[model samples]
Target chain A: MTDLPIVLRFDDVSVRHSGSHVDAIHGCSLEMKEGEHVALLGLNGSGKTSLLMAAAGLLPHEGTIDVDGIRLENSSLAEVRRRIGFLFSTPEDQLLFPRVLDDVAFSLTTQGRKEGEAREESERMLEAMGVGALANAAPYELSFGQKMRVALSGALVHKPRLLLLDEPSGALDPPGKRALAALFAAHPSAMLIATHDLVFAERCCDRFILLEAGKVVRDTVQIGEITL
Target chain B: MTVPHAHPAHPLARLCGGAILLCGCLVADHTTVAGLIVLPAVALSALLLQRTRLTSMARLMLAGTLFYLPVVVLASPGVALKGLSAAIVGVATVSSLGPQALHDAIIRMPLPALVRLLVLQMVHQAEVLRRESVRIHQALVVRGGVDGIRGIWEFAKAIPVVWLPRVLFRADRVGMAMDMRGYGAIVPAARSVRWRGIDFGVVFGSLGVAVAAVWFSALVLI
Candidate 1:
């Protein structure tokens, strides 16, 4: 355990929708080491989101899930959340603040930093994301690509240990998708990205974990070997 | 992106001023004075905020006045003045404060984090819906097959069918996003309000106006 420095561990974990008969994910087990970037590939409703949600502690599971050796449970939810950054498939979902800057600064403020300091850091993050010009604009006013970049900035501003990205390439233009992949390449945190964009996943991820009907049908370290 | 600073007045001051204007409109015997005072105030605020392009405001007021024009022609002078003043004041207040100011003020309110977050999102959702509606209309226009009244009918029919599904899907995604970000676990963070002397003065001044309006109306009634 010490040699590999596992950042995430899922052991026999399963999740079902509240009123549904089928489990979204069933008996899935996976391990991610520090600096690992894994692509979660699946069709719609195949539990890619559910798996990411479970890792982020957003959904309850039957089996144990741990992040950086910390168990995800009611008592540890806040700590778990603080250590992970989750980006939604739609930028609209995550860019909730009135101003783009405020949205980017949200995590820092929630972590008890002063507003000024948070804003300063948020500005730096937006600038780094190449969206500094959109700081004061409402999220609704931004283009889809701009909003995505801003959402990415918000997720990464606090520098969490792990990132859970849901379809980061979904709405982006080709150039935008390429830039996002490059940005992910530079990020230091471990990441598990759920996406159907195979080309995009190949660009940024070193491993592919494929799901089918809520079960892990394929998990391969060799990206070239996998096809969905 | 740079965050826009709060209004010149503190959030509390703006709230109190809004309340005062609302009360004055409610009690004043004649709409003319209230309209005269409030209209200029709104215009001044708009000018300060640099939102001076008044096309929408003008269009709305024109439509409202046209709707009430029959009343103006047939009713007594007092009745006409009342209708026009009410419309003017209402539009002026809404346009001046707008959603952004109210949003800023709402964030400063000592409400629960979840409530504030919901309110903010609701405001944004309204904008999103409006934008989506416009996009749908634009798409209809680009199709170039539908035209005139037929185009209007088709556009109207298509909006709900096309927009609703997308909105619903987006809503689910948003809810999941909020959950992953730990939205309800703790109160959401808001910009801290710093009330300066001017903020206090503005609040008090609004109170004074409210009191004076009450007195003037009372004496006139007597």
Candidate 2:
């Protein structure tokens, strides 16, 4: 962890949805260093998704978010998005294209990669996710667990510098969870994952940040402070 | 060896065919032309029927006819039958296109990004709602949750209160997801458009039919 670069920073960030009096996230500050694995933990409606979305530039917020030293603003939104891969909580939401391969290759194509190259990379990514055979299959045809794996492949296909995953282990079976743990171990990019699966988090994350009511209530190094 | 047959008409060609027949149905004045439209519509419907839910399509056509009957009859008794026939042809054309083909047509069209996105989302959410509704109804049947008239009423009420909100929420998520992948607000990279010889053929054929229909309707029907 010595002299590692900062990949993501949130400084006094606050977000409020339209017509809502309360901020979804208020005055939050956080940092994720290069190659770091951090777990974001909180109860439902605790602004976990909001934090990740803000980091991904999906949600507009007050204050500053710097991705790889570039401030996240309207002008830099596209560049920021190019640097961070966001995996939604619901796999169905993320898997947009008709076929699994098409969905996985969507980001690559959007980023100006040729179709053939994007498709080859997408196939390789799906192979890593253990769903290579699902390339031709329609997303609607896959089971929930299969969809989750396919969605993960899509998120990682572009190979961004930072990854923001919301509930990475939702609907995964034991084997699928193990594959995900292996993926986290093998992934070279920094990751900030919001998840309820403490057991799975324990296997991959080195730090934990707990949020309560849109505030960071606890931040701990996962080395010796907590078992999960 | 047997002669290699030509590939089936591309989805775009079928889409153009459907559009032409639908337009003809719209402008058709004489019973003969309207009657002629039924053959192609029926042929297309027969081809597409195998790919879709026949029972649902049949039910929808029946409902449409019932709803259109009174208004059509009020205008002219002779036109009532033709109006019903037109409605059936329209339904059959749509049914034959299938959702996937329709999606392909929209994607290939040089439409504005927002319009394309709206159409895509509408189709996706409709499909999702349809599958979920089927599952819900099946569950209701298995659990004996719906009985007779009351059950139907309950199901109808459940659609608006439960499923609609769920679909809307899903649509919102899909929108955010699209944004994260560099699709929203940003003009996406252009997909390659391949216009085939068959597409040109279809266009020419459609133009001929359109001109003939207009001439026939003008000189004979009026």
Query: Candidate 2: which pairs clash?
Result: none
Find the 10 residues in a row with the least total lDDT in model 1 chain A: A89-98
lDDT, candidate 1, at B8: 66
- In angstroms, how far off is B153's CA in candidate 1? 5.9
Give the distance in Å from residue B39's predicted Cα in candidate 2 to where it truly belongs. 11
Q: What i-RMS does each candidate reach, in Å?
A: 2.3, 2.7
Deviation (Å) of A211 in candidate 1: 1.3
Candidate 2 stretches with Cα past 4 Å from truth are A223-228, B1-7, B27-60, B67-94, B97-102, B110-118, B139-144, B147-152, B184-211, B218-222
What is model 2's DockQ versus the real complex?
Answer: 0.44
User: Residue by residue across A102-121, what tens digits does model 2's lDDT show?
Assistant: 77887788888887899999
Candidate 1: residue pairs that collide: A135-B1, A135-B2
Tens digit of lDDT per residue, candidate 2, span B46-89?
Answer: 23522335665567567766866796758754365456545655
C-alpha lDDT of candidate 1 relative to the true structure = 0.74
What iRMS does model 1 reach? 2.3
Candidate 1 regions exceeding 4 Å error are: B1-15, B23-54, B62-91, B97-102, B109-118, B140-169, B183-222
